[model samples]
Structure formats: C-alpha cells, structure tokens
Target: MSQRQVVQVFEQYQKSRTQFVQTVAELATRPMNIEILQNAGVMSLLRPLLLDIVPTIQQTAALALGRLANYNDDLAEAVVKGDILPQLVYSLAEQNRFYKKAAAFVLRAVAKHSPELAQSVVDCGALDALVICLEEFDPGVKEAAAWALGYIARHNAELAQAVVDAGAVPLLVLCIQEPELSLKRIAASALSDICKHSPELAQTVVDAGAIAHLAQMILNPDAKLKRQVFSALSQIAKHSVDLAEMVVEAEIFPAVLTCLKDTDEYVQKNVATLIREIAKHTPELSQLIVNAGGVAAVVDYIGNTKGNVRLPGIMMLGYVAAHSENLAMAVVISKGVVQLAITLSEEPEDHIQAAAAWALGQIGRHTPEHAKAVAVANVLPRLLEAYLRAGATEDLQTKSKKALKNILQKCVHLPALEPLLHDAPPNILKHVVGQFSKVLPHDSKARKLFVTSGGLKKIQEIKAEPGSALIEYINTINNCYPEEIVRYYSPGYSDSLLDRVEQYIPA
Candidate 1:
C-alpha cells in the first residue's frame, strides 16, 4: 500500500464504531496508534471522530499514549499539541465517573509531556474539577485524579507551587488521611511534590500534624501502603532534613529497621533505600541504624546474596558510610566485607559492580587504613578490570578512579606496593604516582627517602642505602647534596645511618 493510502486507511479505521473496539484492543496490546493519531493530516481526520464521541476515543488515546509516552516523547507531545486536552477536561465534569477517571489519566499523560500543557488543562477548570472529584466522585476518578495531580505537581514544580498557593494542601492533606491505600498513596505522593518545591507547604502539613499518621504508614499492616508511605517519606526527607530527623527521633527507626527484614525483596530494597537517604544529612542516625543491627543485615546480604538485594546493600553501605565515619569503619570490620566488595566488581552484573565500586570509594574517603586493606586485597585491580568490562559511563569511571586513587595514596609503601609499581599495568603505575603525589608531598618519610636515594634513581632502588664509604664519597662528590642527607649521614652518625638503613630493607 502507498504511504499516503496507508495513512488514509488508518484514518478511516479510526472513524468507525467497530474501530473503537479495535482501538481499545490495540491500546491494550500496542500503544503506537496514539502517535498515528497525531501525524500530519491524521489529527484532522481523527478529531472529527472524537469531537462528539463519548470520550471513549479520548480514553483510548490517553491509554495508548501513556503507555508509549515514556519511550516516545514526540508522540506524547503530539497528543498535547492536539485538542484532546479540552475534551479530557470537559469529561472530568461528566456525571459518568468512568469518563472523569479516563480524563484524569489523559490529563496525567499531558502533564508528563509538558507542564505548560497542564496549565491549559488546569485553565479548562480541571483543577477545580479534580478537587470536586477528590470530594464528590467515584473512587476510580478520585484515585485517577489524585495520581494525575501527583504527577503534575511532582514533575512541574511551578504547578505544584501554584496548587499549594491555591490552597490545595488542605484537600491533599485530607486525602492522605484516607483509609483507602490507593487514595492515600496518590495523596501522599501529591503532597510530597507540593512540599518538594514549597517547604512552607511541608510545614503546613507538619503543623497540621500529619507526621504521626504518615509515620504509621511506614509500619502499616498493608505492605503496599507501607511502600507508598516509605516512598513519600523518602521524598519528604529529601526536602526537610529536620523532618527526617524528627521522624528518626520519634522512633521511626525501629519500624524502618523492621522493614529491612521483610520477606519480599522489593520491600526490603525500598526500606533500605529510604533509610540510606535519610541518613545522608543526619549522621547521628547511622548510630540508630547500627544499634538496630542494620550492619549485620546489610553485610550478610552483600556477602552471601546476589541480584538486586546485593546491589542495594552496596548503595546502602555507601549512604551509611557517607554520614558516619564510625559506620564506614564498621563496614570494613564486618566479616567478608572487603572480599565481597572486591567480588562485586567481578560479578556478572555491571550495576552490582558499579554499586560495589561506589561503596568502596565511600569507604576510602572515611578511613584510609581500611581503604588500604581494600586496595591491597587486590580490589583496586578488580575494579579497574570491571571498569574495562563496563562500557563508558562518565560517572562510573570518575567514581572508580577516585576509589583507586585513595587505595594508592594509602598503601604506597605496603607489601603490595611493589607489584602495583612494577608488575601492574603502566597506566596503573602512572595513576598510582599521580595519587601518590597528592599525599606524598606532606609525608616526611617520602621526602626523606626521595632526597636520600638521589631522587633520580629507579624506584626499584628507592629503599637501598649505600655503605658509609659510598655515602661519604657521594656527599663529598656532589656539590648539591640535600642538607638532611649531609647532616644525618656524616661520620659518627654511621651507626644512626645503619639503624635508619635497616628500617627500609626489602626483606
């Protein structure tokens, strides 16, 4: 079929009543039709079919595009650029709750594509329509509108700020108090978005005494609500460190820690993630986690487990270490942590290795001695090998490089040092020297050794000390011998020299 003819056929197909059934099926099985709906000359053809139709077309359009929206921005923009928005808004006021719910979904898809388009959706009186839906409408519409507003408010900060400015917080706060999990999830997510850009709005929620109720959801009997609440809390903690501190102070740690033991891996992962984020600005909270025995759980997961669980445990360690030096050190002391951290870089999964590499970096930043153990354990070479296996990602390479530098800086004179210096890759030696310079300038031992060894000899001879006659001849022969070398190695100082000389022998 000709391309234009094919377009006409699809256009004609969209116009028939039988096509509506087929469209729903197509939307369920495939979402590409929404893009076809927006092609040049296609919207003009489809608009006539949808102009007076009972929003079934619009519902199908929303479903089609929402599924496809994440993968294809062009198709999403085309829907917003078309006139389906007003129809969706009009449907929000319909007596039939199904239409209103469908409209909410479409509005959500529009908001996802462009916040600017949401203004038109709101300008079409969708906000008020949505508010009424929250209060007066079907459960489905209420949930859909709540989810839509959450997306808009979160993705479009200005719209969220406006929504809060318009006194939407009170209604949203009420929705958070709902007994229904679905409504509460949507409400909490929406409120989080509003508070994200408006701390004052968050204060409004807090001052209105929402924390206790929200905290209860973290320990809620419903696992789904618990996840939603935890997700909301994670976002809130991002905005208000004080509130996060307050949550921890109010004994939320015990409940959050309990989630660390959930049978469901997803619940366990999210709980660990939330705890990690909250610990970022509150280092003291790390003690709470440690006291609650989170270290054992995280270490055991990393050492013995695999897959998603192991990966999150690495990220959690990084987060925990970031906030507390004690916790970072504690991770190093944990059984098999060093070995497992090295193993992570060799795991078949690249993401797991990346997380491990990141955690190792965090450990190095907090404790150089522990960082040395990790490096000398051959973790540095393992990480470099993983970096090669993993394709180019600027962040991964940057983080991996920082971790490697820390390892080198701490262990330059270690037993593993010579191998890294001689047998290791040439680039590895260059990196080691680069990192060594960063710390070596401040090291008296390094400075003394550099001057005593003539500074120009191969690093292989760096620890070798000449006999007294040789030293005297060198001091007498070289006009510019370093002052410390002359002062320490002259005449009667021979015994002191012999004492100093024995300290650096390779054996």
Candidate 2:
C-alpha cells in the first residue's frame, strides 16, 4: 500500500495499454492480420480504449478501429455493431487535434462503406463535431474532417443534406481556399459529394461562393486537386441551367479544356464529365463549349483512350451534337464521327457502344451534309452491324437503329445507302428506299446503278403492304426507272418466263 508500490503498478498498466494499442495499430495495417485481430475479439478489446483517459491510447484505438473497419464493410459493420461510432463522435469534440484526426478518420472509414453505416455515424451526431473540427487550426484535423464529411455526403441526398444542415459548406469552401493542397483537394471533393445529390443541395454549395473560389484552383498544377475541382464544378453545373451558366461565367472553359489532356486519366475523365454537364443544358451552352474548341479536345480524348474513361468524352460529343445542327456540324467538322466510330467498333462495353451510337445518331440527324459526314467515315454499316447483332443490348439496338434511321433518311448520298439494301431489316429498308425515291428520281445515273447493282432486284422482292410507307416508297422508286427495267428486276420474272415454256412438269 506504499506510494512507491502504487506508482510502479500504475506505470505497468499504462505501458501495457500503449503496447496493446500500438500492436493493434500495426496489425491493422496489413490486410492479412484483420481476421486474426477480429477473431481475438479485438472490436470489444478496442471499444473501451476509445475513451481511455490517456489521449494517445484513445487516439491509437480509434486509428486501429478505423484501419480494421476500412478493410471491408463486414468489419465496418462490426464497428457499427460494436457501437464504436458514438464514442468516436464524442471524442471528435473533446479530443486534441491528432485525436480528432483519428476520430474523424474512424467516422469516415465507417461512413465510406454504405449509406446505412453512414447513417449510423450521422445518428451519433458526428456531423456537428466534424464540422467543428473543420474550424480547427491544424490542417491535418481539417483535412480529416472534410474527408469524413465528404464520404458521409457521398451516400445519398438526405445524408448530404444532413452534412449541409450541420453548417459545413462555408467551412468546406474555406478549406478549399486553405494553403494546404491536401485540404483543398478533399474539400473540393467533399463539395462534389454534397452537391451531386440534388439541385437544392447544389445551390447551397453555389450560394456559398464556391464557384469563384473553386475556379481559382481550376488550373492548379496538382492533378489530384484538379480532378476534385473538376468534379465539384461538374456536380454544380449538372443541376440546372442557371447553375451551369454560373460555372460557365467563372471563365472555366479554357482551364477545363486544358485538363481534358491532363496527365492523370481521372483528371481527363472528370474534366470531360464537367464539359458534358455544361454542354447538355442548351445550344447556347453547347456553343460556348464549341467556341472554346471543346469538341476537338473531347474527340481527341475519346480517340486516345479506351474502356470507361472514354464514356464521358463520347457522351460530351453526343450532348454537343444534340444541341443544334450548327453544333453537330462543329462536331462533324472536328472529325468527332471518326473517333465515335472507333469507340463503337473497338469498345466492348455495350453501354459505351450505345453511347457512341447515340452520339453518331445525333451528329448525322441534322442535314444531308451532316449525314454524309458520318457516312464517309464508313460508320453506317457498323451502325447497322450493331443494330442487327443477335447479342446487342436492347439499348444498343434501339440507339443504333435510330442512328441508322436518322442518317439514312437524311442520306442523299447514294453510295452509302446502296450497301444497306442487301441487309437492312424491312423497317430500315423503307428509309433506304425513301432516300432513293427522293434521289434516284432526280439522278438518271443513279437509276442505272440501282438496276445493275441489283438494288432494283432487292426492292422488287420486298413484300410491302399496299398502303404502308414502305410500299409507297417502293412505288416511287419503281417509277424512277423504266417499267421494263423494274419488271426485269422483279422477284419471279425469270421463273415466270420459264414456266411459260413448261410448268416444270409439276402440278
């Protein structure tokens, strides 16, 4: 019971506690050790240490829990089930800066997995504490807090609104303006997650002067920072016309165009996505993109990349071309069709092909010149191939077919329409004939080629109902040539002639 004996005993307990936490922290670093740690009932072991009277012990415990929970949702759920979150949220308010960082890290690690786990963090009143941490003098603490808020907001709109209601937007905006590049990157990303859910939430971000501050870093040399900045701007611009206009007004086009060729693929993809969001709003907005030479830049990105990275670029072309004939021509003039055709042929994902097909259709639907631009790229046959493939997705089929119909109808160019004659389905065959009905009547030379190429023969064999447009189109095409020429190409004319000689001796 002496003072010396009591002091020795207290020191022994503190050293053992520190060693246990240090061991747990180290073990949590390797993915292989998580199972062992979990089976040792580590969650329970660590629960009380989270509030250990010593700050390092408490902080280390939170760090260990975060690392273990970060391994997978199962462990994250274990963290949730172990009721570790409330304590972490509680510590976020009471702890020192480093402890606050570790606490926010635990909350973020849990929230990053699923909406349900994020809800648990929110249910523990973590947002307000984390928002308070954003005001801390330490950059590390603020960075961790911003990152946690970003992850929580990323799950859904309601959770995002919860982060917003905690008064985090202005603080996050300030974080982006901070000198610490890491804080800026995460704050920018957190802003993206918050605004990506809905227009009202996006307005909150925009109202806080996020655009001008964010725009200031649009061309920041750090590729990671640029990616987040691009994403945040895209999220805001995606919501409404006025908001997109706000992004455009920030003079973001040149910097955005530069990032389209960023060394980082994510930066390239994200910036392309930003342009697509802007371009989808209206012809005026699309024109703004085209004026900045966005069409050519996006087309270049599509050409040089593969897989999902090219999707936003492909879609940007579609959105741009969809706006007006002038914009479509801008895409066409930039050789957008050529890159799009390559994606259609080379990209394996059906959705990417579908997007390419949809963009091509948008490009070719505007005028004969536009259609011819697509036609000369040898894209029509490929489009038909996509449409008719047995394995084609319904979306791919619909987009390709619509592209074919759009192009073929506007395609006054006879050569492109000729090959489709042999294989186009009856529905599409009608557009082919309709084009010939309009053009062959005006070009005697085309009528000759139609007969010699068996285009006439193919048409004669088509059995169209008398009153449908196909039949009417067939009639118009027939009237373009001599009646004998049409009869000579008729399906059974030769057989009828031979039957006249002998009924083939069969009844």
Candidate number with greatest lDDT: 2
Off by over 4 Å in 1: 1-29, 32-84, 192-210, 221-223, 261-265, 303-312, 323-325, 339-343, 348-354, 365-369, 372-376, 384-392, 424-458, 461-507
Q: Please give each candidate's TM-score.
A: 0.69, 0.95
> CA lDDT of 201 in candidate 1?
59
What's the distance in Å from true for residue 206, model 1?
Answer: 4.3
Clashing pairs in 1: none
Candidate 2 per-residue C-alpha lDDT over 118-233 given as tens digits, one digit per residue, 9 for 90 to 100: 99999989999999999999999999999999999999999999999999999999999899999999999999999999999999999999999989888788999998999999
Error of 1 at 240 (Å): 4.7
Q: Candidate 1 versus the native: TM-score?
A: 0.69
Regions more than 4 Å wrong, model 2: 1-6, 496-507
Cα RMSD (angstroms) for every candidate in the order listed: 10.1, 2.7
Model 2 poorest 10 in a row by lDDT: 498-507
Which of the numbered candidates is closest to the native, going by highest TM-score? 2
lDDT values, one for every candidate = 0.62, 0.91
